[model samples]
Target: MDFETVIGLEVHAQMLTDTKIFCSCSTKFGGTPNSHTCPVCLGMPGVLPVLNKKVVEYAMKMALATNCEINKSCEFARKNYFYPDLPKGYQISQYAYPIAEHGYVLLDVNGEQKKIGITRIHMEEDAGKLIHDEHNPVSYVDLNRTGVPLIEIVSEPDMRSPEEAADYLKRLHEILVYLEICDGNMEEGSFRCDANVSIRPRGQKEFGTRTELKNMNSFRNVQRALEYEIKRQQYLVENGGTVVQETRLWDDAQGATNSMRSKEEAHDYRYFPDPDLVPILVDDAWVEKIKADLPELPLAKRERFVNEYQIPAYDAGVLTADKTLALYYEEVVKLCGKPKVASNWLMGDVMRFLNEDKRSIRECPIKTESLAEMIKLIDEGAISGKMAKEVVEDMYKTGKSPQDIIKEKGLVQITDEGELIKTITSIIEANQAQAAEYRSGKEKVFGFFVGQVMKATKGKANPQLVNELLKKMLAG
Candidate 1:
């Protein structure tokens, strides 16, 4: 029987606020284990929590960007759980009333558009990290992240494949970063996802038993985890084993999912509205203020790149994947006025270097202005495309301008008409048979003469000049 995979993601994005959601503690990623803790965040007795206004503003920005309808009034609730990482016996989160709801994210899968429904986006505080000692049987709790502000985005079960889940995740991540609300750093746990995966018969209207997958730290891992989970459930159902509802941890190294515990239903949390914190009333003025300051998001920028810049949709998507990189491409285009050239070099060599070193485009050594200058050099016939690549490498290494590298390395293109004609004549005389065949019916042999001339000039010869001069010389 044919089966279809169902996936829904719950993404937790750490807001870029300077302080925790309900406390005045620093929200920095790395610090001493308990240095950033306080009475408010540590859940000490006789301490009352105060909500951070900035956190709400950031959440509103994301909601508006994702087309979510903001709830003018919402309340916080306590989620009951027992874990060492959660210093507070119960976590403060949204249950009865969330911040936003009824949104959708659009993705393009193989030239076809797909819409993934967003159930809700709510505000919550992150739990602390539990550091387990490898050498001994002891574990430590780091309370620095105890009260970090996070907005959890819950997606409806609209994705039918692992790729669709990954695509939706990336689209969400890109928008969050573009809005500058979250850093979207998966390694540091700023942006993370929990996937709910199940498999059911293709024609069935009902859903199958689902398992929640956690500890997917990267986009690639999210796809891998979902793929593995889907296959495992399908195997069990095919072998006459009943699918169990539970939570699982993705073992990346083992490439499998291990049972963590039985999944908890809604009542397990014993949720209730918090008495200390009142309902938040997000007025129209506040939402409009955030909307006015919003930057152009990825989807809008991608459409502009294709329609205005005349580049391919794929190139536009890649260039706009990261906000910083997209800005860099635009600056280069502004400098050179050649969007296609800038897009090619940025997507080709610039991305290659960034990916190779595991670096962000913001950390790129080559300046956008310098890249524009290099493209200008290519347009002016000062260097060939191949030679410009070498200059770009040197520029990336020393952060030098292309002109300085070319002058220092003596890699100027041989554009002199007289010099190129003399070299082409010499090549024609050396290869008389091929040249004669070119004068006859063997038109394909013309490329041989051009290659010979370029080889003689060591790839510095102006290719257009070489072709024109070679054709004129061989005509006789």
Candidate 2:
């Protein structure tokens, strides 16, 4: 039976707030296991949890950015659970009423736009981490991450393939990072995903039994886990075996899913409105203010780059993938007034250098002004493209201006027509055999003469002038 895969992702992004959601404890990652804990986060008696205003504001920013509708009044509920990591028997989260709902993000799937529905975006407090002793039968709890601010963006089961799911996750991750609300670090547990995947016979109306997958730390892992889970369910159903509804952990090393436990529904959590915390009331003025402060999102920026700058859609997508990189490209274009040229250099050599060193655009050694100056040099014929490649590398290594690098290396282009003609005339005389073959209509030998000219000029000859002068001198 042909089966179709269904996927939905629940992403929990840690808000970049200084303190935990319900307490003043530090929300910094990697402190002494429990050093960041306080009376409130530790859930000590007689402590009343206070809601952090920054958390609410950050949630609002994401809600608005994702086109979610913010509720005027929302309340927090206690999710009853017990684990070594969860210090409080109940986690404070939004259940019955959430901060936002009914949002959608568009994905470009195979040259078509597909909209994925967002069920809800709710604010929740993160639980602590449990580290088990390697050689002992003991486990330790780190309450540092406990009570950290989290906004869970729940997507509807609208994705039909693993690629779509990955694309959707990337879009959300990009938005969170662009909004500056989350660092979007997957490995650090700042940005995480839990996938609910299932498979059913194609054209079936009702959905199949879905299994929740956890422990996928990266986007590739998420897509891989989903792909594996879909096949697992399909094989089970095809072989007349029942598909189980369970929470599974992705064994990344073994590349399979292991059953963790039974999946739990909302009622299993025993949610109730917290009596101590008051309800949140968002005003229109606050929503408008957040909307006003929202940055141009990735899709809009990409489209503008294509239309305004007249670059390719692929180029625009690569340039606008990151906010900082997009800003850097814009600055380069502004300085050089060569949008496509700037895009090529940035997308080509500049990005290659950064990726090779595993550095972000913020850590780039070549300043935007320096890159623009190099592109201008290329446009002004002050240097050939081949020479500019070496100069750009030097600029990256030494953090110097392109002009200085050009002067230091004495790599100026030999664009003088007279000088290039003289060199080309001598090249034709020296390589008379190859030049004779060229005159005899062995046109491929023309490249040999061009190579000789470049070698004769030590790669300083203007490539365009070389080609023009070589064609004329060889014909003679």
Candidate 3:
């Protein structure tokens, strides 16, 4: 029997706020262990936790961006749990009332648009880190991350494949980054995902036993872990073994999932409304303010890039994948007034250079005006495309202007009609047999004469001028 994979992702995005959600401690990462801690964050005796208004505003911005309905009133609850990383003994989160609910994001899967349902998005505090010593059997706890603001986005079991799950995750990451609410750094743990996956018979209405996968740090790993887990469940069911409900950890080295512990149901947390914190009330004015400030999302921008710029959808998708890169492309197009040319250069050579250095668009050495000017030079036949290739590399290497590099290298296109005519005449004279063949209707030999002319001129002749002069001289 064939099996259908069901996947739902729970994403935890760290808000870009200056201070902790309920304390005045710094929210910066990579500080001395426990140096950013304070009495409120440490849960000291008689310490009152005050909510950060900025946290609520950021949450509202994300809700509006994702099309989630903001709750008029939401309350915080205590999730009773015991863990070393959680210094409060019980984590303060939303249970009975969450901040937003019932949202959706569209994904482009197999050239078709797929909509993924969002169950809810809530605000919570992040737990601390537990550092384990590799050399010895010792463990350390750092409470610096304690009380940091977080927004948990829970998706419905709408994805049918690992690829769809990855696309959905990328869409969310892009939106968050575009809104500037989250940095969307997976390696730094700013944006994290937990996937719950199961496999059931294709025609069955009921679901199979599911497992929660953790420790997937990157988007590729999330899809890989889900794929591995789905296969594992299918094999177990086919071999007459019962699939167990548990929490699993993805071992990246082994490329497999290992059972960690039994999964906990919601009732296991013993959730209850917190007495210390007051209920959050979001009025119409607040939601409208956030909605008005929301930036154009990735999908919308991609469509605009295609429709307005007359570029291919694939090019638009690649160009709009990153917010910074998208902004850079738009600036170049605006300066040069050539959309397709700008797209080709950025997506081809510019991206190649960035990938080779493992640098982001923000760190790109080539300036936008410089690239626009280079494209203009190519348009005016001031330099051949081949010469521009070298010039672009030099610009990237030294952050120099293309015109200056062109002048320094003396790599000017030979657009002079008289100079090109003399070279073409010499090529036709030397290639007598090929020139005779061309006059005898051997049209393919025309390319050979063009190659000879370009070689004679050191590839400096304008290609259009070469073709025009070659056809006229060969015919004569």
Candidate lDDT (C-alpha), each: 0.92, 0.92, 0.92
Give the C-alpha lDDT of model 1.
0.92
lDDT of 1 by residue, 146-181 (tens): 889999999999999999999999999999999999
Write down the worst ten-residue block by lDDT for model 3: 260-269
Better of 1 and 3 by TM-score: 3
Q: Point to the candidate with the largest TM-score.
A: 3
* Deviation (Å) of 176 in candidate 3: 0.7
- TM-score-better candidate, 1 vs 2: 2
Clashes of 3: 0
Q: What is the Cα-based lDDT of residue 423 in candidate 3?
A: 84
TM-score of 1: 0.94
lDDT of 3 at 160: 98
> lDDT by residue for model 3 over 1-476, one digit each (tens)?
89999999999999999999999899999999999999888878788899999889988888887778999999999999988888878899998799999999998888888889999999999999998999999889999999999999999999999999999999999999998889999998999999999999999999888989999999999999999999899999999998888889999999999998654554388899999999999999988888888889899999999999999999999999998999999999999999999999999998999999999999999999999999999999999888889988999999999989998998999999999888888878878899899999999998888888888988889999999988888999
Instruction: Tell how far residue 187 is off in model 3, in angstroms.
Output: 1.5
Please, what are the lDDT tens digits per residue for candidate 2 over residues 29-84?
Answer: 98988999999999888899999998999999989888889999999999998888
